[model samples]
Target: AQSVTQLDSQVPVFEEAPVELRCNYSSSVSVYLFWYVQYPNQGLQLLLKYLSGSTLVESINGFEAEFNKSQTSFHLRKPSVHISDTAEYFCAVSVNQAGTALIFGKGTTLSVSS
Candidate 1:
């Protein structure tokens, strides 16, 4: 079985300020992890994914996440965030084996203000 947790339920920041949303996962077998973002009035979309090879992955919009196997963590970070960055961020994990389950965190709401 696998589980995901988003440490902070809400993160408020000013525009252009750096921010981070922490995520942690646990699984008995190999798994693939991803981050998804949900903008206000829009559905969720993929932000970044960690499949294999490098432990670091990034989104086109300046968001980045480093998968740390030792810590079982995949925390998302942005050096400079804009107001548009405000949204709900979700951390999800899927087991590699067939019929395995996909789990998602409760989600963290990031509120970026001007």
Candidate 2:
């Protein structure tokens, strides 16, 4: 079986500060890791993903995450976040290349303050 777990449900941070959101998974086989951000009522947008090869991956919007095999974790980090970065972040996993249905966690809300 494959499952994803997000350790934190919320992370409140002031604007321009660094942040980290923890994500862990349990899978019998290799899988794909993905981080998605949801702005308010909007749908989720892909923040980053780890497919193959490198254990580290980055997003265009300034977020990055490293895949840890032994820990079965993929935690997201950002050096500095803006108020606009406030959103609900979801961690997901897919078993194989099909990558069709993604198993999503409850979500971690990153509340960026001014």
lDDT of each: 0.94, 0.93
TM-score for each candidate, following the candidate numbering? 0.95, 0.96
Q: Write one digit per residue (lDDT tens) for candidate 2, span 1-114.
A: 788899999899999899999999999998999999999989989999999989989998899999999999999999999999999999999987563689998899999999
lDDT digits (tens) for residues 1-114 of candidate 1:
799999999999999999999999999888999999999999989999998999989899999999999999999999999988999999999997676556999999999999
- Candidate 1, clashing residue pairs? none
CA lDDT, candidate 2, residue 38: 95
Q: Name the best candidate (by lDDT).
A: 1
